[model samples]
Target: MKTKFNTSKFLAIVFIAGAITLSSCSNDDEDNNVVPELEVKTVEDLDGSQGPVFFSLSTGTAVQESATTWDIKFNSSNFSFGNGAEGQVIEGIFENYVVAPASGYSADDLAGIGSLYTYTGQAASGAQHAVLPTPGRILVVKTHDNKYAKIELISYYVGNPDTNSEAFINLETRPQSRVYTFNYVVQPDGSTNLK
Candidate 1:
């Protein structure tokens, strides 16, 4: 017995296969363009007297200052990049920034000295002398390993209290200082494409 070829059935199968292939290709493209979820972490009560609190953006955790894998450090209110690492504070909202710049990253000399926040002196902050995070300040950093990460300085006080509220304005009710809360994204691919 010989089997007969059905043209209509064969055409239908080919069309279906083509549609499935096109759908898969479209999904692949979408996946490539999708942005990764941002990582939010906080370093609590960094005391300069006790030394700096080192952090690793790649691992999204605080590391030992002496650890070779650390990427950045926080001493009191000051922060600095690890060896071979550099970064700058860009003026913009964190969510608005998409890609990291190609150049102009700094390691030390002036890494975290008033780069992300400003001091609300006795007369400046309405009887509340505190350090406040500057509005629209975003920190973009290049890890010591050459990977890129962008940071958003959230709060200098513990619990991330509302800075504008009366509770935050009152020095007695305000949260403790030296707490660093921020959101960051690390491009593990070592490319400037932060998306």
Candidate 2:
């Protein structure tokens, strides 16, 4: 006897196959929904006159990309006067000094000696905004006293963006006022050198 293929059986088989295919596809779509996120390095403050103040970057804060500028802010109170001079000395009097430390002149007694000076000037506070250059490196220096005296390091560029490096400051105390000289280097990963 010859067996006949049933149309209903064929239709049922087709339906089951289509359902299985759709289920597998749906699982793949779910997997694709997951997105990878970028990892950012943490920033730590180095030691200053008072010593190192340990702190971490704010969570969820965006990492400045290469070729882009970023602004970082510090409290005015954080800065200590460089022992070099409180104010300015008089004209033609090299020996005289203004606002000397309690003890005799020592290397560490001066400002910008072992640590960066925390500038408390209006210009310094105003210039906190920064722009990230390609490869992304920036150096900023600021100087200020508790009162009226203040100095600022503005949009100063020195080297390539790829190497984000630490900037240096040469603090010179003059009779009229104090002067700050800024220099910068490129960092390895093209990030700001937080010294």
* Cα RMSD, each candidate: 3.4, 19.7
Report how far residue 117 has shifted in candidate 2, in Å: 20
Compare the candidates by TM-score and give the number of the best one.
1
Q: What does candidate 2 score on TM?
A: 0.26
How big is the positional error of residue 50 in model 1, measured in Å on the Cα after superposition? 4.4
State residue 116's C-alpha deviation in candidate 2, in Å.
22
Query: lDDT values of the candidates?
Result: 0.77, 0.27
Alpha-carbon TM-score of each model against the true structure: 0.78, 0.26
Error of 1 at 63 (Å): 1.5
Off by over 4 Å in 1: 1-50, 111-114, 124-127
lDDT of 2 by residue, 12-104 (tens): 999999999999999999999854322323222222223222211222122222212211222222222231222221122111211222323
lDDT of 1 by residue, 1-195 (tens): 999999999999999999999999999999999977655555544443455678888777777777777877877777777868888889888777878999998776454546787786775545367777788888889998899888877777778787788988888888777777777888888888765
Alpha-carbon shift of residue 39 in model 2 (angstroms): 4.7
What is the alpha-carbon lDDT for the whole of candidate 1?
0.77
Indicate the worst ten consecutive residues by lDDT in candidate 1: 40-49
